[model samples]
Target: MAPKVLVVLTSQDKFPANGNPTGWYLPEFAHPYEVLKDKTELVIASPNGGEAPLDPGSAKAFENDPISAKFLKENKSLWTNTQKLADILPRVAEFDAIFYVGGHGPMYDLHSDANSLVLIQEFAEAKKPIAAVCHGPTVLIKAKSTSGEPILSGASVTGFSNTEEDQAGLSSVMPFMLEDELTRVTGGRYVKAAQPWGEKVVVSKVAGSGSTLITGQNPASATGVGKEILKALGL
Candidate 1:
């Protein structure tokens, strides 16, 4: 049997004023879900529990793309039965790995969520690979391991860059930019692709730690991020 992987998503359903609702982008979450489900048992969890909204605009390509549509329909159950982040507390330790799916929602919600923070820390403490993409890496801003050290400290990682934020016309909208916060929290150099919306993923092994944290630049990096996670696990 394939290893069991917990895919954690943000449940924030509202967008900031004059902004778009931020949750998991359909392609970013669905593409990885499709690939990972084929080799592992997948479980979905979210911050506020229950349903996660998909950024409608981000679903544009998948709406016209047949393969993405089929994958979406096939995973309807997982989509419908998302476990609340709080509800998954006791069960987090059971997963082989954890993946945080990004959307604008994470920018507003993931940082202050203690349950989400703890779970990420739990995975880090266990030395399991933890993966995130796009805005998903926002969670790492405040995620401290059991030792109280921020997880990304001194670890090279990438996330939805400020350049991408500027390109998306959301530089002033988001509560905080992931690139700036990740760098501030860890004092580590956070890097990104020179261009916005490019596929740039960085996988770094936490200094002297067995766990590998992988992050992708934008929605475009979802599949590459997933592939890196698989490689990290030797799958």
Candidate 2:
């Protein structure tokens, strides 16, 4: 049997009503989807189990790219048929890894959500790799290690930077900033690369073991992040 991987997405659509354009970017999700497609049985799940928003700007800008074009063609089927996170109620030991795809929606929905926390704990306890990119790392805010410490504590990780939020013109509106919170939880020792919008991937050896929780700095880091995950999994 092939290894299975679970992919989680934020179900949030509109940004706090008056906020700027914010939602999942197409390549952020699609790159990983395509990479894992050939080797792993992939399962897509959303918090609410309905239409997962695609940042219109990403789709419009990259529509001509081969991968982006393919994603657009299959967009409806992949998202519409997505399973509800609640329905699957995944146990981390049942699969090989869990990946969280980022969009602005994750800041609104994944953080502090109970179900998200459950999945995080399950995956972490099972010692399975838990990979995230961009604002996707926001989901780790609500997760705790078996010892009750912040799950991200002592783990070198990176995510959407405050610089990126500023570039997106969302620095003022996001409920919580990723840079501040990640540092706070990690005791100011977390590592990051380049600027907010740059492509960077950080693979941290969690608990001082070879097991890793890989993260990508932003959308551009998607494919590299997926590659890092596959490398850590020895795939």
1-235: candidate 2 lDDT, tens digit per residue: 7788888887777689575566677888889887878888887888888767677777887787788789778766777667788776745566788899988889998887788788887777777888999989889876886667677878878888887788878787788899788788777855566555778888875553335788888888999888877776789
lDDT of 1 at 37: 66
> Model 2, poorest ten-residue lDDT window?
203-212
Q: Clashes in model 1: which pairs?
A: 22-105, 49-84
Q: Give a tens-digit lDDT track for model 1, residues 61-112.
A: 5687655687676866776668888888898777888898887888878767
Model 2 vs truth, CA RMSD: 1.9
Off by over 4 Å in 2: 17-21, 90-92, 207-211
* lDDT (0 to 1) per candidate: 0.80, 0.79
Overall local distance difference test of candidate 2: 0.79
